[model samples]
Target: MLQPVPFPIRKECPPGACICERERLLDDPQGDTRILRLTSEEEKRLVARIDSISTYADLQHIEERMREQLGIDLRISPGMHEVRTVRGFNIQIVERPGLCRKTRQSIPAAIRRCLDKNPDIAYAILNAHDLLRDD
Candidate 1:
């Protein structure tokens, strides 16, 4: 994963957006992490699947499946747990803001590399996903 230092959260970040970006660096000063947005299909499926996840084991299973199928990791962020809802819980997935040069360049390369390797996947990572800002 191409991880970058945690840039401060922006005012625009939704009220309950994840703080994992902040905590990750504290846990491992040298750890590199990449934040990726879910594809529309992935997002839809996640909304449906989340309702079924009632336990840690269930969540792990879904996370693994997401990784295998979407090439993204699903982590439980602090914001996710803190959010309140009447019917269901809230989940936020945000990319680190103010990505450095290396991190910014890597995103396009990663997107292209995935496209080149898989002819079956037919979406433009650069265009299809909201990569830069959470808005």
Candidate 2:
């Protein structure tokens, strides 16, 4: 049986960037090298792929579910959180989503309010992508 030989391919890069092609010698275990920049959607797809519980084909399924339920994405760190001291005597309210001077409002306040109200919330993040799709 005969097999056809493969050929090499070339690509161009944008200005101010260098794209070098390197080929390692035989016996070297190192594989090919490459750099890739993934978009947020790409990251979500990867996450969904890695998720064992969700048999989702893409991030959209999980994202839509999360956004519909949480009104935020998995990356959305709440504006605030409440913690009870180990002694169980003191309850602390922490607001780190500092104030937005532009609107003279604090992001933490909104986050905190949401967290304080939802005691059963296991995880709350702003799923903006999924929320937007709903509209």
TM-score of each: 0.29, 0.19
Best by TM-score: 1
Which regions of candidate 2 are displaced past 4 Å? Answer: 1-82, 85-99, 102-105, 122-135
Q: What is the C-alpha lDDT of each candidate?
A: 0.37, 0.28
Clashing pairs in 2: 72-125, 72-126, 72-127, 73-125, 73-126, 73-127, 79-111
lDDT of 2 by residue, 10-124 (tens): 2223343432221221113342211112223443443344332322133345445534532223333323433341121121222111111211122223333433444332121
- Per-residue lDDT, model 1, residue 42, is 40
User: Which pairs, if any, clash in model 1?
Assistant: 3-33
